[model samples]
Target: MSEQAPAGWYPDGSGSERYWDGAAWTAHVRAPQPAPPAPPTDEAANVFSKLGTAVKKAASDKKASKDEALRLHEERAVAAGRLVTSGIFGTSTIEIYEHGFVRVAPGGERYAEAEKITKKTPYERLRSIAFGVPEAERAHDTEGPGSPIEGAVMQAMSGIVRGGKLLTKGTAVGIAATGVAHLASNSARKSNLVIATDKTIHTLTNQKHNGFIQVSQKEHNAVAVALVEAGNAVLGIEPVAVAQPSISAPPDAAPPAQISVAAVAVTPSLSDRIRELSELHREGILSDDEFSAAKGKLLAGL
Candidate 1:
């Protein structure tokens, strides 16, 4: 009515087009308002929270697995039974006897359970059960043809116990006796005469006098195989050899000669002596003739 507009459109005061329905202008032609900022959905929030929890759990699991593996490796290392101390100075071996009651020291005390002595100890208390008098009683007996315990004790004391070298007959006998003592203790199931030489290891299996002497080469390659096959039979472990090389000399032999080494003072080098002499001459500390004589002497010595 005021000025009349075009039939299909209405003119807004801003000079932009407006849609006109039959009755009124419509706002469809105006720029649309930005959509309201969307709120986070419950599903999306839950997914993010779960992802964070899963990451934390995976890290915890990895840490636990690593810790468990380390514990198992330590356990296995302990069970393998490596030598703790070299039985060089004096041996502390376990003894098992024939009666099934294990005794640590012969005729001393009987242990109701072997596990009580074997388990949870830093050093293994070896048990052997064979026919022999108590270590204490054996010490008092006189050795020679008539004494059984004396003969055995003397045999055990015959070698280089520290170096593992059994270089003499006495040492060999001593090793055999020790083996028997081990067999006679509470841990031993049977006895054997075990012998180790430089080239071979021999075992007289069974308790029979002069039983089967099984032989094997003393090479590193065969140690495991031999040990496993021999088992707890006195032949299983490496036997200390008889000290066949003999620690004591024969009656006619003389004592070894002692050797002595004397230390000498180091002389100056020829070049150093010449330089010193030259400097002395230049400083008037030495005459030219004296320097020449010293230089000649040093050169000749060199």
Candidate 2:
């Protein structure tokens, strides 16, 4: 605004204090005043204490953040009806839901496979689920020795066997390959999750490179309980209490007995006899065998 301003600290209009010398802005800039320093040893101790406090506060904040995230995740899952039961098995996690379930792998190629499976499956189509270790896992073990001499002999034998007709059969080879592949891919799994619909069943293994989920007995029981509840709900089964029949004594009064009259021989009509027998049987007065015998006699007389 003027030809020249005093060569001291002045507002730069950017809210910072800057030094202007003679004609233009100078290299030197004015900064906000720093807090006064503490005593030498005390300063060092204070810095260390402050650093420790900051670290502790950071750790506490991080823990709270993780807890909040988990809480939100569970809430979302419940709202979506995608969480029936869940357990952490090693580094992986397995969730069982009413319609379907999702297993998150820890690492390796199986993780990709698990993701692919999850993408393809729609929860509505799921009907039933089962899980177990495959029986074919036995094939993963080799019987041969590692000695050089034995290796040479085995190699020679293997070459000789390769020329045989057995090699032409793809069934055995296929089975062996499949077993090996399954072993390698699912080595980390404690058990496989078998998801089934009306048409097909899918096998899911929770695995990482060397980590697998070990579901505890309590988690297993919880899963069973969830499945049972879901099945009952789906089947429209409801619980109800049955009422018991009450019998009251006839007013605690005795009726007068009729005196026996002189015998006047009278025979009931055929229809009347049949009805009387039926009534007696209905009232539990006649045993089944007695009723049959009496009915037969009465019919014969008719």
Candidate 3:
């Protein structure tokens, strides 16, 4: 019989024990247990973590840019005093007035005739005198002061009865020469006030034929304020509620799964092999028979 081995030692190395000399097991063999699989390193973890962070940052940046654009548009609209409603024209820093006058007849006789005139019998007698009898019968027998109805009819037709004048005035509120120039050019034909900016000044000067009123800075501001107030007053008839910007949902997070590096690695496929063989054949590197054989193999594998 073989001598008994030490207690801690196992035959053929299949136990977690060590051999000690003299006082303990002297010669022992034990199978080494494999090390636990290493935990992923920080660098590898950071790659995927950083990718997720970048996706979030990019979404935030896009939202910020959109918000900034919207803010700028609102600022421009407010500065320009643009109407909130569609199809309504915006107010400007200009003032416009139109005036006209109408006059009756020359003297008291026309006034008396007008006073006697009624809606039912409006100049009926005058109409009969003018169109009743034949032209020959209507002739005046006597000359001078008592001419038969000719002078009375002529008097009735003259003065403000058939003629009138229209007057228009346009004034620009606090504006520079450039502003005046713009007003003169663009609105020459129509009577209205226009606001001036650097872009419009040259056009205004070029079209100086239009009449315009140029006001001091203070007056311009006052006129602009007045116009804005007037517009607001009209708006007061039906309250205009400003629409608030819509709230946007937060962007979705990136996918949780990591993209495997192997997927993106370029490897030659069947098509690439065929193309390489075709190129080699064209360059006379392979004979037609070799090319055909290689191409057949590639197609067969496919």
Best TM-score among the predictions, by candidate number: 2
Per-residue error at 243 for model 3, in Å? 48
The numbered model that scores best in lDDT is 2
- lDDT, candidates in the order shown: 0.35, 0.43, 0.32
Cα deviation in Å at residue 34, candidate 2?
A: 37
Off by over 4 Å in 1: 1-39, 83-224, 227-302
Candidate 3 achieves a global lDDT of 0.32
1-302: candidate 1 lDDT, tens digit per residue: 13355445545667565676666677756643455879769998899999999999999999999898777555644543443211100011222322121112111112221122334222222322112122222232122232322222223233234443233454244336445333212111222223232223333222221221111111211222232223223323333233224478899876555432111112324454354345334433334444565456556555
Give every collision pair in model 2: 89-213
Clashes of 3: 6
Distance from true position, residue 155, model 1, in Å? Answer: 62
Give model 2's TM-score versus the native structure. Answer: 0.23
| Candidate 1 vs 2: which has more lDDT | 2
Candidate 3 lDDT by residue in tens digits, 120-183: 2111001000001111212322212322122221232232234522112122121232342332
In TM-score terms, candidate 1 sits at: 0.20
Q: Which sections of candidate 3 miss by over 4 Å?
A: 1-39, 84-302
